[model samples]
Target chain A: MTAAATGVRATARIVARDDGRGGTSLPVLEGDGPLALRRTRGSGDEAHVMLVGAMSGPLGGDHFAVRAGVEAGARLRVGSAAATIALPGQAKGEARYDVRLTVADGAELRWLPEQLISAGGSDLRVTTHADLAATARLVLREEQVLGRVGEEPGRLVSRLVVRIEGRTLLDQELDCGPGAPGGWDGPAVLGGHRAVGQAVVVRPEFEDRPVSARVLGEGAAVVPLAGPAALVTAVAPDALRLRRVLDEALKSLG
Target chain B: MSRAALLVLADGRFPAGGHAHSGGAEAAVKAGRVTGAASLEDFCRGRLHTAGRVSAALAAAAVLGVDPVRLDAAADARTPSPALRATARKLGRQLMRAARATWPSSELDALAREFPKGAHQPVVLGLAARAAGLGALDAAYCAAYESVSGPASATVRLLSLDPFDATGVLARLAPELDLVADQAVEAARECVDAGVDALPAASAPLLEISAEAHAAWAVRLFAS
Candidate 1:
């Protein structure tokens, strides 16, 4: 599918299938620009893709959204091509992107996207909601860099809500302002950290595990990954290594 | 006259075995998901709406003698993390012992006999709250507070914060206490009327991952 025209309302739909051989594949449906799909060789048939688009010229403020819906008993591996830059808005200095996903019973969705950079005075919000049937599985990753590179830092107000069976599972509101108190400033919270990210993996397979603890560090301490069906989170400096570690860990899960 | 009793239930040192678990804070801290008091507050707030509220509501119903078996099942469905379920059972056991000592009743004894493995903490806690002459709202508030404060107070020791500062944090969180407690009471009433099986299931995936990771850790300060 060709990429959508610049400044045009655009929507991308990608459907993935479980090959029944413990592998997954994505087949692009309507899209524009460059959306490449392939399977990782000798890696238990993991689906891989790269989505690249142009933002230059009259296409400013053009919105992009992706909807991925998985069928029952299917497994999917989803990711992005490059870091998404939320360009300065025409009026508010920002752009918007939305991602919606659904996983069916006995199916799994592994969604990992690159860090999003929102320029100073930019306004952006990404909301991801997933509906899971009984026994469905999901692994979602989202990373945000609040400001531009080596410039006056910008502000990013983000809200993330996830629900299953019409019930809210995770509802997060992050407002990062300059010198916000009791926010990212204290010793036990975000502290002085600028880059923030989260990865979540859910399946009934690990239902015997407990839900409370002090510290969960095993395998690698500095990288920030968790679980038997481990998900990873890391700052920009460690993101690449964390990604590699995550890929290796996920590969081992099969 | 029972204001002292309410205070005891609300106190951070109630010894309901809360200090033994971090309510997913420890795992989040280890993962760098939460670092200090401020972030901890945010995490607590998020939970107050999700798992914390669900547990509080279920507990309120249980205290009202709504039906232990159904409440347990509903709680099991709502709690996706296996680690959390075990912790609930453990906390339930401790709460039962304390509840029996404070106010023993045949209903409590029967519920204990029916589920020797240990009832879900919320279910037992609700019963205990009712036995103590607390209303559904109070039961919900106490449950929600314990749910968050258990971890907050635990983090104080785990992160080595001053007790005074820890209590201050709790005091600051007091306003939210009423908000979530009200939500829980309303939700519990709805669930009880609808039947436990009809209760909504709300599970936080990241929190679940943290709990699973914590369970697998070789060295852990808390049992959760």
Candidate 2:
């Protein structure tokens, strides 16, 4: 659901620190506004952190950050109130946000949510770095769309890095511009389609058969009917369905 | 093209729809698993060592006139991910059609007809390489290039990484291609002189995971 459009441009930061007792405490700060935060620590070693009605406004190209740390054996569930959109700026023409997460040994982190939309002429750069131990389980989902309703695709560039014990597990850079080649060239990558999203689930080890069966069953809708390429799509009214589909698809992959 | 028998192993128009795949790059990109050009490069490199190497070796064996059935079985054993296996078969079917049109080799035609469900891409590619008069090394290099280029190209669209930068990543991988091709050719020679039972095996768990994950995405842009 869309929150009331606020004109305030403010920064919100949430820091979750492990208490060394297998539980973690979170402190949230949002633009000097009344801090409304909820922390639920589950018996299954899961720490859930939610920020509701935290920030509202055009965001005025404001900066925000979410920092999460999980000590050994503690898991964290991180999410936001709604889909974060980068509204257009008058002069600079774009917005930005940063997210950092760290998971210690035997910890798990699941970061999932709505799409990141960049309105026309809006430029956004989102960078996320996660440090995980050898046995830590991590899942992160990110969906980015350029432009608003009926507007041409905006320029968006995003970078993400996942590291295990200072060793880079994954590093990627994506830039969507007007004159790009290959993947964005219509029928090649996105098939000239708009609104692309992806989710990733990573663990230290898992059997291959179950993972394959899971992907096939969960992604049955989007599995390409022809060729070696695997692509699937469906029109949806909201982001939740899309998120569920992605989560299901990733679970299959795991 | 004859000097090296350039048989287009994974062309975008080849109906294998490999054009729609970024290998595991798409999943990696979506999961925020891949961050910069260097990491993208590593992903490509890792695939070369695992799937890429296997495909190249199989293609090289086909070029050396190894039995298609044995090569196909080896490919099946190496590709533990079902999504990948399905993709390889689809690509194999497409390659068979193209191979029939471009170069009419009865053996390839028979192999395709016999294995109507489609052989693995590497198996089909190896057979096509033999039909095109390419040596084992040339066939292996072509197979390696085709296997790696699809994802390297896909990363451009998935991440919007600079096309020039992406090309540079491929260029940097030239040495890898050579090394992999050499290894593939050697592996092919070993497989042919000995047999599938004598072939070596190596597994990369992450590549399989990424492939499975990419397969599960609901609204993915690429096929694999």
Candidate 3:
């Protein structure tokens, strides 16, 4: 084997608790390596957290993880300041980013990370998993841009798995860019689109009256899941249009 | 395993209710993406690899004695679109009728009873293949081939193009089909050890997106 950089391994954890004074408290806020977590102001009782990059290079061969937990009656929203770029590094191994989210009874979590851009000559595989209690609520959004401007995309594989109680809500994996299966850019797949986004909203109220399936606009559609959740998937020629489609779909979902 | 049974299971006219759905080709055709044989070939190839790959692995795993209930849940997890899920179950229900009449296996009957509305088509297909004395590879081949063949035939009817051209498209994709089927079987083997998470989850976003749109069409030639 050729000599190469071993890669960076980082883990960040955040836990939101229901404070007695009608607000949420972050009793556990931890960060390591390139994953920097900071607690910012949130509206009302919600606790907001922003992910700030401490350094570049989730490049090839990196291992990163983020775990967020919301206790009963707590509300937490997580977002990133900017898009995370996956770049090629000295090593040939694929980068790994795993996100684990948990919402307790009567808790709510909004995971709205910015888009992750896969740059040329990079390989990144991301898996996001969320487990919710029966009465929990979650809004999770994921957007991926295949490549930077004016270049072919590297290999990118992303999977999102969400479960409520003990039942699966939505589980899907999208593989794209170079070394992916053929026809990924074909009409039936991305249709020459370089950006793809999905948003999953879960609320207990949906159990009584589920959301109807509808197309938000061109390149986007929202459909209710078998569980008390609705999933909106959108693809566009670029990141801007993709975000727009998801925004409109979220509005309609609201 | 019976080689002839594989052929019978893979037959297009197997009365599985697949004829009503265009497999997303109707939307692609209306969008002017699949105008003729060349574009249809491209479209079929896309389905063959993404959706096709996933379906084949699920089918192959089902043939490997995986629990039908768990496999059905896995299939549900893989399919994000409700319309496509409904179509798959509808086709699965229809295929269940055809398979039980032909093979009369207890597994198929039990699964049918469990999912009275229907299980996913790929899961039913694997059970059907098992009832027909076929192997995992055979199930995978059938699933992968149908992924492309359905779109091709649908395009033929939607565009009213020559059937021979559609057949040719399938012929050209024969080698890739074999490769995908083999990959699916390999993944299925891993699932036997590592669980359903080992199965490939490749998805075609456009197909899932357009299937929702196609389902809302006021007047459409195909069901999906």
Most DockQ-accurate candidate: 3
DockQ of each: 0.09, 0.05, 0.80
Stretches of model 2 off by over 4 angstroms after superposition: A1-212, A215-254, B7-16
For candidate 3, write residues B144-175 as lDDT tens digits.
99999889999889999899999999999999
Native-vs-model 1 lDDT? Answer: 0.62
Task: Note the clash tally of each candidate.
Answer: 21, 18, 0
A95: Cα error in model 1, Å: 8.4
Among these predicted structures, which one has the highest lDDT? Answer: 3
Candidate 2 TM-score to native = 0.48
Candidate 3 residues lying further than 4 Å off, grouped into runs, are: A1-4
Cα lDDT, model 3, residue B149: 89
Per residue, candidate 2 scores C-alpha lDDT tens digits across B1-224 of: 37534735445455555786787788767756567687777667666655677788888888888888877866665554568778889888988888878778998988988789899988888788778777788778877887678878889998888889888988998887898889888888988878763443433444554576677667889888
Q: Sorted by lDDT, highest first, which candidate order results?
A: 3, 2, 1
Determine which window of 10 residues in candidate 3 chain A has minimal summed lDDT: A1-10
For model 3, residues A1-254, the per-residue Cα lDDT tens digits are: 12247788888999999998999999999988789999998999999999998888588888889999999999999999899999999776999899999999999999999999999999999999999999999999999998889888889999998998867777888888888877878888887888999999999999888899988667888888887889999998899999888988888878
lDDT string, candidate 1, A1-254, tens digits: 22343333456777767777777656544464423333433245545544455443112345557778777777777766677765554432234466778887788777877777655655554556666666778877776665665543344545554556654454443445342222332222333444566565666664454223322233221111122223333333334544554454444344
